[model samples]
Target: MHELSITQSILDYSLSEAKKHGGVKIREIRLLLGPFSGIVPECIQMYMDLLAEGTIAQGVKIKATTLPLKVRCRDCGKESEITRRHIACPFCESLRLEILSSNDFIIDSLEVDTDGD
Candidate 1:
């Protein structure tokens, strides 16, 4: 799965961050994933666990937050989350809405621990 590569990238980035702080070890990583990001959270976690097997994040935790799906209607000038299959605008019943949200996969934050000097 590509999540392996994804986690590898995460590790690379996290390691860079650790370096910036005098090589402090990371305690956990938090991610924000939208519904339309097309990534399964469980799969990411599984891949992360495998990819981090021999890294500083070996015992770290990966947390994910799911974002909502929001759309904007072109005809009725409405913006909201829609999931009824009938993608028409709720105000004018026009299927001219365009997706406005639920299309992001991002790393939100990192928790690191630096030993006492």
Candidate 2:
């Protein structure tokens, strides 16, 4: 599925970064996911576990945090967090809104073993 590709990308990026930093292994991976991104953390984890076999990222701890959808009202210019179902501006009830953060898929941080121990 799509999770497989995404997980592959993550693993590749992580491995590249670890190598750049002279890391012997990856210890942890922290992810920031958006509510509207439609990326399932569990699926990502499962795919990572499968794809990381015999790699530096094998057995790495994966932590994912889902962020709320934030939007800015065009009418009142107020930023507010809204549920995925309701995208309208909460303050002015305006349908005109600019999405601030909703479809984000970011790698927040990575813990790598650079000591080669």
Candidate 3:
């Protein structure tokens, strides 16, 4: 499953960051999900949790944010939120639409803390 790869990437990157900072314990991960991104949040969380065992990410919390699909209609010259995945534009009723946003998956931020000193 690609989710494994994604989770691995996240861990690999985060681990590097932690190591760079002398092994800080990650507290929470804030992620931004794109509407068109194929990665499922639940699947990611489940796999990440399992993969994080014994790692710096152990006990780390994951927070996912939903991203609404946005499209620009050529006919109506308007931008609107798309609920469904298709060329269907509700406001303009036109097939001529350009996707403005969607299909974006990124790790926004990671909170890590070292031993309380």
Candidate 4:
């Protein structure tokens, strides 16, 4: 699955950063995933668990927060949260909308054990 590639990227980046920090072991990796990002958290976590074997990130916890889908109506300049069921603007009922969020896949923070304590 694509999640394996994505998880591999995450592992690579985390390990690189940990190496910069004197080879610290990763404790947790926090991610912010938007609803429309198309990356399933469960799948990514499973892939990470498999890929992290024998690495410094092994047994690292993967935490994710799903961001809401926020859109702005281009016609009326109104902002609203929309789900997959409804994409039309609530105020002006306009289909012309600009997505403010919902396509984000970000690694927010990494918790590392630098001192080995």
Candidate lDDT scores, in order, read: 0.76, 0.89, 0.81, 0.87
- Report the error of model 1 at residue 104, Å: 3.2
Off by over 4 Å in 1: 82-94
Tens digits of lDDT, candidate 4, 1-117: 778888999999999988888766898999988777788888988988999989999999999998778999999999998876776898988999999875558888899888654
From the highest lDDT down, the ranking of the candidates is 2, 4, 3, 1
* Per-residue C-alpha lDDT of model 3 across residues 1-117, encoded as one tens digit per residue: 898898888888888887787766988877888776777878878988999999889977878887778889989889887765655688858988888875667788889987654
Q: Tell me how far the alpha carbon of residue 94 in candidate 1 is from the true structure, in angstroms, after superposition.
A: 4.2
lDDT (Cα, 0-100) at 91 in candidate 4: 92
TM-score of each: 0.78, 0.88, 0.78, 0.84
By TM-score, the better pick of 1 and 4 is 4
lDDT of 1 by residue, 90-116 (tens): 778877878887556788888887775
lDDT of 2 by residue, 2-106 (tens): 888989999999999999999998999999988888889889999998999999999988899988788899899999988777778888899998888756689
- Count of backbone clashes for each model? 0, 0, 1, 0
Best by lDDT: 2
Candidate 1 clashes between residue pairs 3 or more apart in a chain or in different chains: none
